[model samples]
Target: MTDTSPASALDQDPPRRGWPKVDKVWLALLAALLALAVLDRAQLGPSLLFTAQALWDILPFLVASVLIAAWTKATGLDRHVSRVTAGNPARAIGLAALFGALSPFCSCGVVPIIAALLAAGVPLAPVMAFWLASPLMDPQMFLLMLSTFGWPLTLAKTGAAIGLGLLGGAVTQGLVRRDLLGEVLRPGVAPTCCAAKRSLKPEPVAWRFWQAPQRRATFRASGLETGHFLLKWLALAFLVESLMLAWLPAESIGAWLGADAWWAVPLAALAGIPAYLNGYAAVPTVAGLIELGMTPAAGLAFMLAGGVTSIPAAMAVFALVRRRVFALYVGLGLGGALLASLGYLLWAGGGSAG
Candidate 1:
């Protein structure tokens, strides 16, 4: 017979701490905004339309993201990336740019991940590239562009993102010294597979899939980890979407960025840098601008430039890397956006006249 007293239970196992407390104030604020969104029927139609458009626009980005994520997991590319970044600065930048183009996280969502990667001894250049590219190159943003702006503009944005990433990485590799990383930089860890050199470890393929009893545990673990990582960031992104949907005026933007206005593209690129808005928020704004008379090219420039050149992003990179590296990242993004815009104008002109 077992004793059922509380003291007996306490003696059997120590109490465990609960999960971290949610920010109730933030939750309340989100709830209030959501209520307002539901109540404001006048704005509902347009908001839904914009969101639908955004959903369509982001499809390509989504497809690309799926492919990239699968590739990373299958190839053990994260481990390889960690090794390359640790060993050579140039390779680090290239890999970072490549990874950034493929990663699903937006700018704000990526902050903690970037910090973790840096802490884990990834090279500064690639880390910076990841910061720049994550917002610009994600799958949802690509789908949003495809639906709202069309393919030409989507391609241009993609090109600019890749170009800026490469240029930024190269500049960072050349300019930022490893010593500046200080305590953040550490010796690289070998791949988990490599680290476990003994035959005692299970094969990689078998380990990826588990026995029925273990499979359930593995799925639960993965779900918990992913949910913890994405939930807060997703909430923030949704809030940004709500704000943009409520405020940005379509007519004013169309009038401001009309195709005949050659200066509009560069102006848009410059204006975008300080906004700190991600592609998720900016897409609706661009759609509004399109309705306002902004050309596809000009809108694309705003989207790409806005996502990559935000003050928060710049400052983040500057804090982690050197001033020269930061400057180069900014310059490349600004320059690439401008070039893409110009090319669009020329192409559109030929198409219209032809």
Candidate 2:
């Protein structure tokens, strides 16, 4: 029997044409360049030069980070995330928070693993810990931040990431123990894809990945894919940063985000929720703001708040969970950013209160 029905055929091989899509980051990059060319022709040349020089300066750190990420994926160490984070509830939450900060999973890559963890009956608290932390700080982000702001701020951000994760996990766990969190998953929801389901059962780690041909291929593929992703986002980020440096005045930035503004830390956190640039693009953006008189505290707050609530990370959480859970996620991100910023401001002694 030949089953040649139109619907069946379409299901087997979905139509690829007529789907309008564009990478937002690349689009922004192109639009920024176009705007510069049309509005300020003289500045265009200087901006391009600035972006190029900035990219060149960060190239070594970028390559090192990308290689490390690829190597982790190739060696299968990422699979141990579940194993290592398992055990006593408190212990699991702590381990999960630490892993989330250190792991190299990107916004999308982390989604499947998170979905799997929840589906496998892992408590929502620890998963929330990992979810909140994963996007905020990773090896790649650490290297980039170190290159831009030096070790002190970079380390501070890393600590904030872990602290935020722990806070979310603890609060969520308390809510759950009281049965206040209600359902963890959306009703009738299931894994969106096979990969999401498959992540529940990860393969064993192969420490000596080079001994296997498949692992070598994995290394090459992951490296190339990661390299392309990092390059494009970093390029776009530096371009926008160059424009910010050229156009946005230091006084305007300082007025809102400077040390003298007592409310600057909270304002930065709230501002970050709406203006969240995805994690990689944010490094240079915050650096530019810092250079333009934004206080270190405000910059850190913005980064933490933005990283957690960035569109991709928020969307991933939204798709898997109910409305209240999503709200909690946002609240935690905002609150954690505020606390971290206030503490840093007091400790750093950047400026006098207004």
The best candidate by lDDT is 2
How high is each candidate's TM-score? 0.53, 0.58
* Candidate 2 residue lDDT tens string, 1-354: 011212223445565898687867678789988988999999999889977886676566567655665565566554455455455778888988999999876443465456546544467889989988887898989888888888767878898989999999999988988988776666424322332344467667788888887777766766675556556665665565556556653334435675547787888887675464657877877777777677888888888887777554565567567888889988998898888878877877754211
RMSD of 2: 9.0
Evaluate model 2: give its TM-score: 0.58
Model 1 spans > 4 angstroms off:
1-84, 88-91, 177-255, 274-277, 311-329, 346-354
- RMSD after CA superposition, every candidate: 10.1, 9.0
lDDT of each: 0.55, 0.70
Which parts of model 2 have CA positions greater than 4 angstroms off? 1-87, 107-109, 190-259, 351-354
